[model samples]
Target: MRDVTIIGGGFSGTALAAHLLEQLPGGARLRLLNAGAPLARGLAYGTQSPLHLLNVPAARMAWHPERPTDFVDWLRAQGRPAAEKSFVPRSWYGEYLGARLQEAVRRRPDVAWEHQVARITRLAPHAGGWTLFDAQGARAESQDVVLALGHFAPADPHPDLAALASPRYVRDPWEPDACAGLDRDAPVAIIGAGLTMLDLLVSLDHAGHRGPVLCLSRRGIAPLPHRDNELQPPAYDTPDDWLSGSDVRAWVRALRDAARQLQAPQDWRDLWVAMRARTPALWQRLPLPERRRFLRHLQVYWDVHRHRAAPSAMATVQRLQAEGRLRLQAGRLQGVQDAGAELALQWKPRGQDALQTLAVRRIFNCTGPSSRLSQDRSGLFPALAADGRLLPCPLGLGLLTDADYHLLDAQGRPQRGLRYVGPLLRAQHWEATAVPELRQHALHLARALARGHAPAD
Candidate 1:
């Protein structure tokens, strides 16, 4: 029997397991190693709040690409709202993923589907396969291993304040009661204006928090909201025209010119969809220098536009802004200091040299995922790097991988029998994060493994 082990039981990992099992031989074994993260939920869908919604619509979130309407159909079968364009709660989606995985295991009783809850910290090549070692020295061997370790927690952006041992400071918002425990009457400073900040704002509002909220980020830009209007793909220039140059600035100009041609800004969303469809090719075609420049200078703006908020979530944020309860600022955090009854957040505005300060009762970091491997706290990634089994991709966004999703070694050669299917592939493919892109990768990788035909590197 071919034995396969998947690390991290998050969305990607769980989905990969289901798809792989469906295609594998009847007696193959599959092991799922989950490190504290809820099976099938992962970081994105683990939120308990019903206020948190999927960025994509219900019809587009199928775990398998071939079954495009599987999620929506499941929702309908359960008598939940199954509108094609509706944004559903993430918790519900998690349940759907879990149910799907259970169904897969149930159908293939002959295949040993072992689920283990442990943190694997070390990996070693053994007997033409691989061995995984957990914290307690427990070991498991498999013929193939897939690194589906989802998103990494954002490192403390302002490391100076990381040493503070006060309950008033929260470095990670995903922790239970992170924002809920804040003093309801006192203001709170959230260190990012992206999706995570929106989530915290919604959570605080639901908890009846009436205090002023400060949403701070380097760019002070918030994601645009999806509208109820139907989505129609936009027709931009021919591939020859858009792909003519590798200059980042030229590409941005072309995109802007295309959007300007349309009368309304909302129409730009169509162009965004088209751009996302082409990101893989566009990203690979650019030289490394141009890719780095895009990340350094244009990533924030691109993100705010590319990844939009659900209509309902955006409306709530807008309502909060109109009520004068939320303030968005552009600045870099300098440091934090103790004050008489609160903490003083020292920061510098976008263009000013002088340091400005804000006093708040509590602070939370919502700066989103950290892509740098050096910042990974888990001992697993560092071990891989030390063993020459992993290499950092360009722009430090994620690990280096070939087009076939095979993890590259220190010498830039694909490591056979070692695969990766997660957001970290963003380093090689700009559109690797969202469900639509990820599901395709999962299906392709699984089919390849089952057929014993590794994709060409």
Candidate 2:
């Protein structure tokens, strides 16, 4: 039996794998499986688009939190700046994660790393551990399993989007040349005007496409700018009931006050850093209703403040908008149809009654990934849930897990050898999906799993 089986090779999985190599007893075996666009980088950081840059900046993008200078040092070793807030390409960070994993693997060759390119269908408890099976008829037995399923696929678009899901439609932005060789002046339609759309504009620009591009969304809200590379220290002491089922607003107020107390040298980023340190507590406190309220009312705002655009990306977007070639339409996508060589899109401009249609050569779904884990395309989680071996978390965000990342049984009990990481943890920890948070979870779970783990719920 394998010592460990990591389901996804993305940042979370790889990070955990790294820690496991360090903490696991000698001769421990491991296999990393991922059906998505390879491991370590996953989808978000796997982008080949140079326009997509790391939002956190080079100084803070290290996979190791305790080793604050890890990424910066690596960058400098590779001839890049170590201490600067450099806006490197997303793919570069992906390469860093890949390299980091390889280095760890080299240190522990007994931990066999397998980049399984097949979808895992089910995992069942067997003997003392578990047996995992992929839809492609592959099987492996492992003492422990880590489901690092990163982000979800994009949510299915409005029914009208079906009209545009053609050769002319780019459902995903990462596919090979989704915009390759298109007519330079061909107008493009982009769904959702958030960070994804902003990045799309840069991609189109780099592709030499100067045609008009229209952005559509219910709320045409854009992200707030990061004024400068300033740090803001936490304003208040850690709350007494930080994670004790209290009001989130009260918590935010407490945080804001704490922010004001931060003196010189520390800028707004310092508050972010402080919040990052104590987020698990904040998330554990808010009960279900408060969590849902945050999702429905504050998710977008929170995302903007948390995941920002690189300075260069923001500049390009502003330049495009000023040129009028970039249009922001606040309305629902009505429909799309063939407009001869191009496509015809119909929508009602916000605050207006009449419907309108525009002809374009392409439409890209830049709505980001679908967030509901219960609605995921993967069969593994559902199979576990169906078998009563795992319960879908209360919010349907992931397979329920205990504090140690052990998958919870259907009775809301813990199951050994089964753990999860990545976006799925959003249900339990509001801030768990991001890189920094995921890295910490990976480290903690690695240590727990190494100790002949038991449920910590």
Candidate 3:
């Protein structure tokens, strides 16, 4: 059995592996399983689109927490000039991660970086560890398993879109040419109005597709841009006070009101930063019904405000809209009909009774990954969930994780050996999406593995 079996090779898993190889006992081995696209890059940063820039600036996008400039230094050495406060492309970040992996592998010859190159269908608990079975009848065991299973394919809103179930439709936005073959003049429909939509807008523009693009969702609220980030205040020095009650609606309203009253000459974004600081304590205290309220009412606003896109990306979208090449509307897409070479979207505007149709040559699902581990379509999560090795969060942000990234079992107890180190901590941490937050979790998990401590801390 290996010392660590990282379920995903994305940033969270790979970062933790790198940290463990350096901090943990040197003799221990690391085995990584990457069913995702590229090894080092996770879903967000895995795209090859040079137009898709990171939401966060370069100053804070380092791989190591202790060494914040580690990535910048590496980039400078490789001739990627440091443009202060600029949001670099996702591909550049991927390169940095890939380089870091190479360095880690070179330094530790015994550590195994096996690109499983196959799907992990099931995970079972053995005597003192776990066994991961590949789709090809291969099984591997490890003392610890980390579910850094980054972003799964987007959740389909039109479950009965049998027309979209064909090869003509693209579910995964990161896949190349997911929007292929549409004439520049032909109309197109996008499922969600988030960063993914912005990415598609840029991609289509670059591809000379000046066609009419339609973006639709429940709220149609787009991600806000980051402006004057330096003025934003920290979420909270002691944010645990917010998570004590089962009344989620009241809590969210109180927070939103508090954010609205910010008169300290702060960036509007700081309100979100403050809210994020206390999310772990707050989410843990929320009861199931309260969490449901959060999902139903607060999820859309939180997503748009928190997960803002790069300014350049937003500008491109705005430019297109001004030129009448794009249309953003809040609607409920009822179904999709096959139109031979194109798909017709049946939708109704938000709060309107009348139905409408938008015929487009293509459609892409960017509805974000499902927050529930139990509902995860990936073969790995369900297997672990069934075995009681992993559990879902009450708020359904992701798999249940403790402070140190331990996956919880069916009985609400932290699984002793296995641990996580990515945005997987979303169930516990609010600011866990960006690299700055992820690096901290990764570093801590590595220390726990090295010290051989239980995951509850």
Error of 3 at 123 (Å): 2.7
lDDT tens digits, residue span 1-457, model 1: 7788899888899899999768888778899988887899998999988889988888788899899889999999888966888888999999999999999999998788999899999999877788889989988888899989877887887876687765578888888778655777798899998998888888888889999988889989998987775334445444556645789899888888877776654478877877777898889899988898988899999999888888888888899999999988898999988886888989888999999888898888899978788776778888999999988875777898776777899999998778888989888888989898998888888888887733335
lDDT of 3 by residue, 1-457 (tens): 2377777878887788788667645456677787757778778778887888888878778888888778778778899887556687889988898888778878876555555665788877789788878988898888888777765667677865633663456777778767677687888888888888888888889989987888998898888887734322454432445434668767667666666766665645776676665666676677677667777988888888888778888889889989998888998998888877778789999999898987788787877665666555667778777677777765667777666677778887887667766665677665677787788788877887777723335
TM-scores for every candidate against the unseen true structure? 0.95, 0.88, 0.90
Candidate with the greatest lDDT versus the true structure = 1
Which candidate, 2 or 3, would have the higher TM-score against the true structure? 3
- As for lDDT, the candidate ahead, 1 or 2, is 1
| Model 3 TM | 0.90
Error of 2 at 219 (Å): 1.4
Candidates 1 and 3 compared: the better one by lDDT is 1
Where does candidate 1 stray beyond 4 Å?
A: 230-240, 263-266, 453-457
Over 4 Å off, model 3: 109-118, 165-167, 228-265, 374-378, 453-457
What lDDT tens digits, residue by residue, belong to model 2 across residues 183-256? 99988888886788877788889888899988888767666555456223335345565433478777667667
The positional error of residue 230 in candidate 3, measured at the CA in angstroms, is 5.7
Error of 1 at 355 (Å): 1.8
